[model samples]
Target: MRKIWTDGLALLGIALVLGGCATSKEDLLPHDHRTMLDIWNVETSGSAGGGPAARQLLDARQALRRPLTEADVQAAPSVQARYTRTAANEIHRQFHRLPNPDLLMYVFPHLAGSDPVPVPGYTTLFPLYQRVQYALPGERLEDY
Candidate 1:
């Protein structure tokens, strides 16, 4: 009985500290893009071609899909999600929509929830938000 009490208390303490690190993922998410980029760096060339380099990029993309960041953490609330699918599948489905071209760079973090999602069949990306063009100096949409 005593051991159970102590263990429970210990678990509670750990949960509080770690949980306090974060709670709400939605707000944490835009910034979570930082974590997403870290994933991209290790996985892909952030390039156009789907040669050996692009797959490597996709690999890097899959690694850091979870939202864990200490840089700006606070006592925010967390989101809990569930799915009928297998655990891994929950994650796969989230980013499954991204085109293969942007898989590693743009898609991973968008998925990687607590729920299981499906991995897309093709290694290539869809047509939406397919290409990312950076803003030129003093350039806005009207400038073009």
Candidate 2:
């Protein structure tokens, strides 16, 4: 009887939770279709850029902002060109790969497959090291 009561209470609790979750998002949210910008303007209506702090921020920004002259615009290209990547600058080649010797392998001709067909011999080259190694910048990549 006690187990039956506990099971009934658990079912009631689950039904209550499901009922709470069944409310549509449209019912929960404001039905008035006000835009985000409209809401922002309404919220900040009385204090829009009129506060002392806002005035000080605007003044500081005005002081920092400078109009670019024709000379400044012309000089911009030279400054950018100095830092631009070129073949002579060698900016991309920061790390040098360490040399790994290739090992030559020759496969002898043999009969292969269920029908026993003659396979031609071939030569192949493989790197001695399993993985390629790279030297850090300023490290001696050349053999001494």
- TM-score, one value per model: 0.17, 0.35
Model 2: residue 28 alpha-carbon error in angstroms: 73
- TM-score of model 1 relative to the true fold? 0.17
lDDT of 2 by residue, 26-142 (tens): 888847887777655554433354455556666787888979989999999987765667787675776679899999999999899999999999999999999989986568977
Instruction: Name the runs in model 1 displaced over 4 angstroms.
Output: 24-144
lDDT per residue for candidate 1 within 1-144, as digits (tens), equals: 999999999999999999978778766655544566665654455533346776865677788675767632543332123323557655554322222233332443233457856554434445446565454323343422
The RMSD (Cα, Å) of candidate 1 is 30.1
Candidate number of the best lDDT: 2
